[model samples]
Target: MKKILVTGATGQLGSSVIETLLKKMIESQISIITRIEEKRVQFQAKGFNAFRASYDDVVSLENAMEGVDTVLLISSGDQGDRMQEHRNVIDTAKKTGVKHIAYTSRCLNNRNTLANKLMVEHFETEDYILSTGLKYTIFRNILYMDAIPQFIGGNIALERGIFLPAADGKVSFALRSEIGEAMANVLLSEEIENKIYNFTSDKAYSFYDIATALTDLSGKTVKYTSVETNVFEGMMKQRNLPEPVILKIVDFITDIKHNQEAGIFNDLEIILGRKPSGLKNGLKTLFGL
Candidate 1:
């Protein structure tokens, strides 16, 4: 009767976690809380106790955690008040006697990325989670390797070339799917206890490395050019991107340029029990080249 609950069950990361769990455990042991009725029904079809809940709604969260022994609090996607939402989930979990809590948090030590509001919010949530004294696992996830296309503009990469404001910044990017599977394993392990884990690739890759990888994979000469921050901003603005989204993208590039995500950690290997693939392989899978 070991019940495990997964929040953000509809998102890419959450879906990965839930998908892996289904392979390892019975459906009765898993419950997914999502606000989308369509997604709720979809998960329900998979034999999960799929139901609706919101981070802002503590009552629903409490109900979701009624018999849940372990809960994975996927960081809320809300831009308005992510920290408060996280607090609500954590508080509700505690009140409902949920024993172990696992959270996907940002790299707290990355100074440059803190300029982004979401990064600051993640820090706040992490602090609150620790303060609550809940048996917790903090996964300080690095940039997802699967996100390279999104981050570096994959559409423009093969056609025009790679252009960004990142100045010699390298990241130990990881695969989101792999991370989700590893996290599921952590949730299932009886021996794993309260700990903070940094999930990342075994090595770091810079933008130049990305360009080279794409070139090799696609049989095209993709080039990386470091432009001024203003120039990059101007380009994004021309694309009719919203002001907030443009600013968020700029902050992400800046963080990479500052080498904020350049650490290779073995913590992921400990949970996964294997070395994650390098950048080129990830790029190939992402671009289908």
Candidate 2:
């Protein structure tokens, strides 16, 4: 039996991946590594082997990898020093003689002209993972449809407008749950190795499309307003968003404006064995109506 350890086990993606794994594999074959003791106890209560591991603590990570054959090294949430954290995980995994690593990364249409500074760490981490000479699978996930609500602000119905810096570029957003399921299936399979898979929806949607979907779903007139990057930053600041977060959002929108996330790929369908959910359906699910 394969002993698979998943990092970030309490996170949304990680939780969904575990849900999927529970159906495919026995509980004893799975382990979870989390920084929080409460989450570790929660998993343990459910009969899972859970460990306390922090990305900043190399010794904890090495101990977590003991007797584990495969690891799902989910990307760290911290944008500034996440690459270093990922390096710690990858290096420790290598030291422990782990067989395979499935890393989650961002989809870059063109790495050479990547406008999103937040994505630089992902590209760099991929390079570092490759350099370690370990068998790995890089899942280049696209923007999540689950994030549209946050991107447009929580109350889009009340706001009646979609404010963004993205000009008219389209993005292929996939459901986070579906992406998690596909990732779990990939981790359980043995066919793919040392390959990069683009996990994106087949259809792409611009902000205008998103606005239209919102209008139709909510039965209200919602419009997409394209603003300058500085203006967007000012609006975010007015909302009491932190400076670092505002900058990250601006960079991501700048990438969208440059059509850096417009690529549509079939890998998601190939992995899921079905067409990925459409944006309208995703929005409906997200809005819960």
Using lDDT as the measure, which candidate wins?
2
Model 2 lDDT tens row, 159-256: 66888989898899999999999999898885657889899999999999999988888888899999888888998889899998888888788888
- TM-scores of all candidate predictions against the true structure: 0.96, 0.96
Residue ranges of candidate 2 with Cα displaced over 4 Å: none
Report the lDDT tens digits of candidate 1 across residue range 31-137. 88988989888878978888888999988898889899988999987565777889899999999999889999865356434556567777777789889888999
Per-candidate Cα lDDT values, in order, are: 0.86, 0.88
Model 1: residues >4 Å from true position, as ranges? 111-113
| Clash list (residue pairs), candidate 2 | none
Candidate 1 accuracy as lDDT: 0.86
lDDT score for residue 217 of model 2: 86
